[model samples]
Target: MEYNIDLQIDKQSLIETKSFLIKIGNKESNWLGDVSIHHQATDKFRLLEAVLLDHRLNVVRKIKAKDVYTKNADSRSTFFDDHLEDKFSLRHNQFPYYIKYSYRIIKRDFLFLAYWIPQYYSNVSTISSSLSLTRPMDYEIHLDSIGEFTYSSTRAAGLITEKWSIKQPKKIGKADFSPPATESLQQISIVPSDINYGVKGSHASWEDFGEWVANLNSGLDLLPEEEIATLKKKFGHIEDQDTLIKKLYHHLQDNTRYINVSLDIGGMKPHPAEYVLINKYGDCKALTIYMKALLNAFGIPSFYTLVESGSNPKSIRENFPSQQFDHVILCVPTKSDTIWLENTVSYLPYNYLGSFTQNRKALLVNKGGSQLVKTPALTHTDVHQTNTYHLTFEGDRLTGTLYSKLKGEDYEKIAYVETNLSSQEKKKYCHKYFNNQGFELIDLTIHQNSRSLPEVELTAQIDLPKHLRQVGPLRIISLPASTMPASEVFKDRTRPVRLMMPIDAHDKVIIDSSQNWTWKLPENFSLISEFGTYQITYELVNNSPVINRRISLGSRDIPIENTAELYTFLLEIETYESSAPIIPTH
Candidate 1:
């Protein structure tokens, strides 16, 4: 079954109607017809029409007023979508059936609208989805699609425009990896072209938008003298601006939980700081507001930055400037570096921007207006995982003392192991630094500082069978080959491959042979590719062999044609690692 939704918008007011045709294949197939609308305190939805049809397209059941119902969505979460629906059942219906329904929605707030162009119309070989938009009065509109989609636009009337049809729609495949939405579909971002929130501010340009945002919250940005004095008295000794910024961020985190209450202007205007302080809870917008207030009290300046929050990085349409962001964050500028703070988290390290906001573009709203800026890019240097191992072998029983530290996104990973994982789970992770097929954890100890992104460390001692292979008089020692478990295998894949996470890792293994043993070190080996670099070093110092291997990926995106080369590069590195051996003489 497939469907199409037609929507009409006039600023904050909107009307949406959808029609779905379902075919009953067998007795086990579904035949119930349904139409639904989701609404909230400000915006609303109303079901307009619903009908069920038989084989001859004859109307079987017309939705009665009693068929509609509304209820609370879910009890498990505080924030959930609530909706009303008009439903009809055809349990005894024949094989062929048709269903159609329509509903209208009042968005009320036009800060942003996400319209996903329909792609699944499979009854026929191909079906095209279209969109038509008309601006209110003299306002302008903006629309665009990701790279995969091709579209053209035509004017209808008084600044009225219509995207007659969408082109180059690809069928959904069973491939495990998903390309970014921006690259997969055409997105129609329709706004009043003026770029203003229409609440008294001119958002025609970044500077205007920033000034308007600054003026919009001018009163909320202030802290009472008593409140400022109290906050200062509590933190009078913290001199560093960055440290103070972090301290205030911690204060905001400690003082509030996220309570979502969309009212008045809806998701556009943020709650006042005073209200949040008294209520002890606020959403992302409110938290950012309160954090800004705290910083203001301390003579520090920060801007309200809007961002699309997610693990996946999404960019603001550089060419089109409208409401594209779903969340708000606070950006603090300083002397040595600009500090980005996530006021929602109490435990993440200060100034440590993880995947949620890292490497994405954001709208920084300040007094001068708004400016588009990029978040910090997580590199091998910022997000690194290093493991150091000291090993000794005696009678096929290998003992290793391993210490490791995870930084950046790598650290962002284990950062939750301490508080979130059970002791057994933590031990399982600790073993990864030392475990081989034949190894056993003799003793393990772990240390961590998750309150900030300083680092997560693990120390372990393991016993394993001697990996040494004796080739006549020369003893061969092949260091354990490090690996990032294979996440994707696009064997015989025809489509473009989606680039996965960038890897930045280094492993150091120091072997202290029996005091009487000596090693003949091999010359260091290095290989640099367009993707990344791989290197191996074998150094024998005072009868102990020090081995270091580094894998630093240069980019996170790659074309499909390069998959074979990438696979070969990784395979060669694996083979080279296993083949390179230290020759130790006893």
Candidate 2:
């Protein structure tokens, strides 16, 4: 069964007529659906209210009165066509029907009316329609629902209006819905259709759309053949199949800008490719088709591919043919691979496919026919980040320099910050990146190699506070200098212990002392807590003490999943210290 809907709306607050035609087997069912529109009344002014029409042709059921509502008012109304029949049914078990409905509003200011068009099965009883017997019965269905809503308001700006449509289907008893006698219900065909109408306050009309495309196509003929040939010779160089296709693919990506424009005005017929080129901007369809035409001029084979931009994973069934795509792209065929090009961003990479297009199936529409194509897989090797740092300590002050290199989408973020941020802002940014480490930055430098790669290298010299040292007979403290005894720092003994220094990672300390300052031994000193490699190496150089302390305490590789553990580990390492009391040496 197939269904079709047609609607026409005017500038007045009236709907002339909304019609529907449903085709089931050899018979066609027609219905007239319309709504009498109204507007809101206000003091010193009156505005027409936008009207919404909801009607499905395939489903035969009662229309409830309470299903509709009006704004700022308590009452609602329900009206039906007196000349048309109330209900209709189909004779064939596997055919589809069409339903059409529309309405209008007089005031151009209230142009934002919308509709919540329900699916056909929402009103139908599935229990009664269930087929009997285990025999195979093939069935297919198609749905075409369109809404043209318009409104204007003085409080709001100009008139806002739109017309949107969708086509969906329901299939039963088949493996992946492949058309054949492989499973039960092998011989069934169903098609559903619908149409809708509304009004808008604009001088542009459907005829203007057709004229625009036609005139643009005619203008293409005016270009000199020699110039066209020259353009082809310059742009078309396909030495290697993959390289050629990739170049052509990148050509479209670098040339066109994407603007979202719908086809309800001209019923999905695209504008002239030459016009789009002059404008340098167009909708997905216009840009895609333009790329296709350009490739054809250069003896390259290409096609238009349509797809939906969401997470729905159902494949398209050939038994049902209807427009279900929300986006359009270009597909170039080469000896080795078929390249997909999206003509939205002039800066997007030639081979980089966004998450929206990743691993999704698309319909490739060519002169021959439509075929399905799956997007290539994305691998972890395509993404990576590298960081390097140099650290040194001089007289209790630690100085370090850091460099970071990023690839893939991560580069996009750092590149923007690198270009826009000032020197002071960059210091603030570095502080944040280092977990708010209290360090004085001496120098900060950022270098970007390429915009396409979107990679940035940052280098900075930073000074950190000195907190640990030994004095005279005993070590003053192994803990950070910021820590103080509770007796002096806190008046109340019950007060919580507080440390001034922020702890992020474990630290290692090496000390070189002069032999003239003789060290006294702490007889009672003992190790308290330890993790990983916490060792000290002592060597005598010219009778002087050269002490090397190495500590490996934190996880080498931080896991995002264990971020909480990492934080806890940081806190634990910060508080860790040897508390064993030192005994005076004789």
Candidate 3:
């Protein structure tokens, strides 16, 4: 894959300047020519022309506007300045076809425009790519990359253009389990080095970057005088700062809904406090800004911060600071605690960063500049999940009530099930979530607790599998077969391992035969490794077979050297679990 960027810079009227990009590739390297171009009203990028030129640089056909599909892209709302997206398709849609296409765009200056290497899920070993830049030498620019990128300049027609190219061997694999920066595949981030947008002074350091953000986001505290006094009146009774924060947070949640409003500079700088207060909705940026404004109303200070947020935690490179964030939140300081609020989730609880932003670095803005701070880490107790089952065996069938509760990072999964699963689909989800090869959910109820912490409760009556064996009186049962939480054995033990999310939880299983039969127990089964511990305990109380299983995983990513130990421990658990069939003696 070859990507070329030709920029005609207009320092005075940046939007008036033109930038053309060309991409050409084929499937021999697993490179399919697919592109999506985005343009907004404030910095409208016009597409002059686009066509597929064969390997010989001959035009096969031009992409017509009619043939192209354009749709409005609202990261949040309709008010976000008429955003447009164009998707182009070439003559065919398979590999082994070589085509080159180019499109011209008019871009706003001083933005972090970039090309991510080895597009998500692309096998670098099967592909080779390069990046070329054609710009005036007068523009001092800095290009950010994790791996080696070549730099060279050529002079032609009194124009000195610099080019940087990165080529990888076919079938090159990437390891991305780092703490501060997740370097999955080397990417390129390009920006003008010594430039300032409005106030973001320079790209030289994180401090300069923060100052620039501070300038663009200046005056975000400007709210209506009447509104400020009224806002103060609302939380004035609460003397304690944390208590006041809880009240104000709940107030914000009840009054506003998340509607994304990202367009042009709106994508970065937020809307004023009054706009969101009147509209009662905003994206992460606008909402964070507005929350800070409300805090200001009560003489509480807060900072608008940027972070790369998602269910799977990601980190920003501490060494190389660039604009790579996708979401924004507010950091409010209290007398003894720092509250991290995710503005987009209107129903978020107080100081609950959820799994998306917890234990990750964020760029907090101040009048002086930017400071890098790590969000509060979620502990084992914080991310807790518990599952319990009460079972009674009658003849050849096993039926019981299953009660489950998930909180913190683990709760995200069950919450998804609650929202996405229909009444009819609940059984299927039960089977999947419980890892039961076969199970029937008699009835299921899901509860989403959104006030204090992110919690989900699932209560159901389930008929479990492996209940009847050989259709005989002396039957065997293995309790908590799939209740243990662990990853299916990882095959790539040689690769570096990084825990994407921490794993820690407890589970219990209780089986009763209605006092009809006595039970047999296996030798104590327990496996302790560096990863954590898994234990299964059993005892008989008045002809009732009581079973308890608990597993707590310490880290998300295990080191490569210890991957074998982790694998062996998990293998033993699976083996012992599968062999724990006990005989019921009547």
Candidate 4:
């Protein structure tokens, strides 16, 4: 892969050309032979060349650029944007072949010059890769990368050319529980010091970026006079700030819906508050500003906050700040506490962030500019689960009732299931977690409790006829399988391992049989490590075998040096699971 960028300082534009030489090894790598070019409607794009070659380097076919299909990027009405995409696929019956293609994109007044990822996947090794950039000698730019690369620079006439390259890069297979690609892969990003995309902006600092965003969204948060008067009259009797904010937030949720709006400078600038009030629908940016306008009616203050929102969010580079945020929320600070409002979803409990936006740095866009601040973090108490089960055997069938309670992220997950799925679908979903090869759900119920950090309770009754097995003279009782990682998962691991999510969970199981059967007592033990802790206890109460187990995992990224310890800890869990086989003796 060869990536080149030419910075036209005088015109404040960037001309990027990318050429790829990919080999199609199998049916799966056939995706590499496909061509897809994405650009905004306002930008200029040209496909210079595309050809398919056989194993002998002879031209098998020539792909014409005119033959490609071009259409709107998004066909859904909920998503409105000015972007276009051109795409075509290359498929052949030959054993081994090569595909070569090159394209150019011209961007006028660009903020980000290039974000290059040479390696397509962890299984694909790169033979050779290079990135070359030519710009005015005096013009300033920002460049960042993940790992070391061979770099050099040369100056000719009035232009400077810098090159970064990698040779015969080895393939690094991804392991289970590995961190996100952006954190564990090789990448590079380049940005100009100053730029304009309808609204002027600079990449020199976070303040400059925020100032650019502030200008785009300025004077857009106005409400009608009659609406303001109505709001004032309605909230006139309420003196408490928290109650007023809650009322306004609930009003925003009830009156407005979320959509994707990507107009006016690529949707960086939000639509006006009046648009939402009149249309009753808006995107994240629009909804946030609408909520801000509602607060303004009663003289309350809030900031339009930008955040990188996801279950496992991309880490924000504080030192090299750029346009890293993808979602917006409203931040309101009172005397006693600070409130964060995610106005996109109507069903989310008030003042709840869940896992999407919690525990991350957010940029607060204000009139003066922007400032970085930390959002609330989650602890074990916030993301935890507890389940209790009582099992009874009747002839060859096993019947059990499960009582499950969940909080934080778990609550959010179940809440989605409760809202989106039907009763039969919910029962079908419960079968997967019951851990039996075959089972029937007798009853299933879910209850959602609304609070700042809400909780959900799931009650289920299940019948399993395949669990109890008779092996010669021994009768064995099978329980739910543990989710601990197996040894084969960490084999040939090269990258660091990290816990996928923060978890604290406990489970209790009780067995009762009409026949007076004696059981072999399993030893109780506990193992603790930096990654997390595990414990299990077994006892006999009222002639029934009672077992209690717990596992608490901390959210930590374990470096390569510490992975041995993680492997050891997981092996202990596997051994403990195998050692506790429930068997009945007469």
- In terms of lDDT, the best-performing candidate is 4
Q: Across residues 266-376, which tens digit of lDDT does each residue of candidate 1 receive?
A: 446777888788888877787889988998887888889988876664556777666668778888889988888887665577777776777778889877657889877
Query: What is the RMSD, in Å, between candidate 2 and the native fold over all Cα?
Result: 20.3
User: What digit string (tens of lDDT, one per residue) describes model 2 on residues 260-345?
Assistant: 54333322445557756677767766776776666666667766667765322333443344343567666676666667676665
What TM-score does structure 1 among the candidates reach? 0.77
lDDT order, best first, reads: 4, 3, 1, 2
Regarding lDDT, does 1 or 2 come out ahead?
1
Model 3 clash pairs are 76-260, 125-170, 125-171, 125-172, 126-171, 200-212, 498-557, 499-556, 499-557
Q: What's the lDDT for all of these models?
A: 0.65, 0.40, 0.68, 0.78
Please identify model 4 stretches exceeding 4 Å from their true place. 1-10, 74-78, 421-430, 433-440, 451-453, 464-467, 482-492
Which of 1 and 4 is the better model by TM-score?
4
The TM-score of candidate 4 is: 0.91
* Global local distance difference test of model 2: 0.40
TM-score of each: 0.77, 0.41, 0.86, 0.91
Model 3 whole-model lDDT (C-alpha atoms) = 0.68
Ranking by TM-score: 4, 3, 1, 2
Positional deviation of 375 in candidate 2, in angstroms?
A: 1.5
Which pairs in model 4 have colliding backbones? none
Every model: Cα RMSD to truth:
5.4, 20.3, 4.1, 2.9
TM-score of 2: 0.41
